[model samples]
Target: MPCDLEMGLDNNEDGNGSPETKKIGGVEEEDGDESVGLSRKMSEASICAAEDDEDEEGRKIELGPQCTLKEQLEKDKDDESLRRWKEQLLGSVDIAAVGETLEPEVKILSLAIRTPGRPDIVLQVPESGNPKGLWFTLKEGSRYSLIFTFQVSNNIVAGLKYANTVWKTGVKVDSSKEMLGTFSPQEEPYTHEMPEDTTPSGIFARGSYSARTKFVDDDDKCYLEINYTFDIRKDWQSS
Candidate 1:
């Protein structure tokens, strides 16, 4: 039987904005009247300094707008909110289940890469006798497509429910998530393109980059995830 390959690319933007700011680290800011008074005081101090002699330390201190303190407080709140959101998003996996040894119901049959105007390139893993590792060089500023195929075992009705791809190099690049409909015995091949127009453009660092794929069952109860690490470079080398 021919193996089924599934691929999908989602660039849809969803609302994951920062949470509302009401308090920070269990402490609320002063009331509106007090805050306004403090701001006015700061403004008055700045004006007074402008007309007075320089500081005794022999250097003049420049004060920004009166709202600087407020802006900084809001920024701190935003950073904390983002940190909590990331923790919740990536820490949903069960720790106890990590020790279980269970074969995946759905297996990755193959992973292939293709660049626009270029031939398709199939990657080989250790199981296929390529022990060194499966890797390919991706040129900067060029769009590449990835195709994923999966083999569904008997009695398994898994499907590609949610899919996302992220690029991490010290920090995360913008990514998209999609909710694909369920599939029965077998799922179709999925394809996705990287560096979509909306994606930020720049020279990606030349090193290992991780590509993660996840497949969930019809009920969204069980899932299988696979990660592929490959290299990207400015130019391809002949072996």
Candidate 2:
């Protein structure tokens, strides 16, 4: 898929190269599926086909918010609470599940680009327990988009609520720390286990999504991530 032309475009001109008379500063253009934030999730168009029609091919997927956890947290300056929560999550993130120490931070200067022959995101249907197809891009600097529907297992939703509660209660930012921290770490890390209640209530089973292109340390390597939370409790449904 092509990255939106507006990905890094200056707003001062139109597609035809005519200067825009508007002088608005800090003005963000509304993306076709604009509800998703800086990290675009999946587009509304693709979302409809995948969730509503049960046609899995309609959902295209990609890798992630490729920045080191730290950079991802810092990018959103306006959401102070979210920034802090992200930092805490990053500080405690376990990559490989083998206790490899994550780099404290990632800088564009450190990323090395090399061609790799593989697809990133894979979409699957739980009922089939098999992947439909892998999401791929023909080039490095391209945008990938898709719609995703997950049965929000109760355990996952509970974890989200707990995390939100922790972030909302008595959190503070400390500029001097090498890695940001929020609530104290629990003795045991949370599990990604689904609970018995995590079934399709038609409430949190499916929904619309959108996303934008993301570059991995380079200005060209692109990826995407979910920009907004789909609570499944209220707004979940096929688009």
Candidate 3:
């Protein structure tokens, strides 16, 4: 089957974490496998599966009561080692920044199309559906990747991941997810870049595709969800 096969991931050594789970091209394989990768194909066969009824709405699936950043720090102050570990997890976060809340809030600020040597096409993220209609147009058979800038607040977001399912003309094409390891709340936003990949080319590949993407934590708390559309064409759309 045609696919948007990823080459490899960046070293992501920014003290946050790196992507560990990559479900590429409508297939769920272990991370680092060579057969497939990120930027899964928008085809007509396999779409991402919802694990359970509750999982249908990933964000609403509760993992029970959780502690806030303030609560975590104040609870184990007497234990020196535990306190140090908490400090390490929080990194250099400002106490004034993270609010006193139960769940970590993640805001995906922007999504950019990164093509070699060209100016980035960045689309600012909204709460849900896109008001502008199409997100971007990628040149068929071009080598490009995607990057996301998001901020976390209140507490740590464990096992953060990116997952999206693609569709073309009501046919499910691909379903996949990538795991970006644990991240703590911080003042500056965190940036994650998917490995380079090439877009599929051919008469069939050039068309509009609709997709739904989610930024979710291990607890099934979805911070940001985007529902949008885009196109793959013989050439990039003119500005």
Candidate 4:
């Protein structure tokens, strides 16, 4: 059975001239046994049983009333996704449940960028905002960090197949990949740094820049893919 997968590009800019940050928050999983190693697929009966148990345990928590309108809207979208996933899983056991999960295996809550000797800066990537694209300015020859904060719903072993940034001209800027080890139902935050010496200066760089990431589960299947774009310029702030 083919894996269930969903892919989308999220890019939003902060009208206030702040750096833009894109957030993809949701659980993604394939049909498999988490305890018996990667290739062993879970039986339909077992999955249905698990679903029943979860349903009996009550629904997942909902967003609080204090959330902003945008937050509420995002929550609504997630809820709709969850509902669709449940329907798909319950409707057919023969089909491999790709994006459908009894519970979210992993969800990316937020992404941020940080510079050396400076506090982490939250990019303003709204659900629906400006379309001029997200912008970020970095000091030439300075190291920068890309941070990803996520939530894991179950214990699972996962790794990044690849995480890289590239220019519109097709030149690769920076990239990294490694096993993430075992994670349980908790928040896991990771930081990847771009070396000051290795990174190209935005002043001389032309065209837009984007970061692409692919995440795989223990089964070595790509469950989630994320792409975000932004412009890098010497005088972007003045424009």
Q: Write the per-residue lDDT of candidate 1 for residues 119-212, one digit (tens) a residue.
A: 7677643343232443565655455555556544322232234344545563444333333322212234333233322112245355555555
Candidate 4 lDDT tens digits, 11-82: 111233222221112223542413222212222222122212223447532211232212222333545564
lDDT of each: 0.38, 0.24, 0.61, 0.37
Q: Please list the residue runs of candidate 1 whose C-alpha ends up more than 4 Å from where it truly belongs after superposition.
A: 1-10, 13-104, 125-134, 155-159, 165-167, 186-201, 204-207, 221-223
- The clash tally of candidate 1 reads 10
What is the per-residue lDDT of model 3 for residues 41-131, given as tens digits with 9 covering 90 to 100? 1111112324331444465344435666676677747877657555665668776667476667788888887889879878887655453
Best by lDDT: 3
Candidate 2 structure quality by residue, lDDT tens digits, 84-115: 54444334434323123222111111111122
Candidate scoring better on lDDT of 1 and 2: 1
TM-score of each: 0.42, 0.21, 0.70, 0.44
Query: What lDDT does model 3 reach?
Result: 0.61
Better of 3 and 4 by TM-score: 3
Clashing pairs in 1: 5-149, 5-189, 6-148, 6-189, 6-190, 7-189, 7-190, 7-191, 8-190, 8-191
What C-alpha lDDT does candidate 1 achieve relative to the native structure?
0.38
Candidate 2 residue 198 C-alpha distance from true site, Å: 14
Candidate number that wins on lDDT, 1 or 3: 3
Clashing residue pairs found in predicted model 3? 43-173
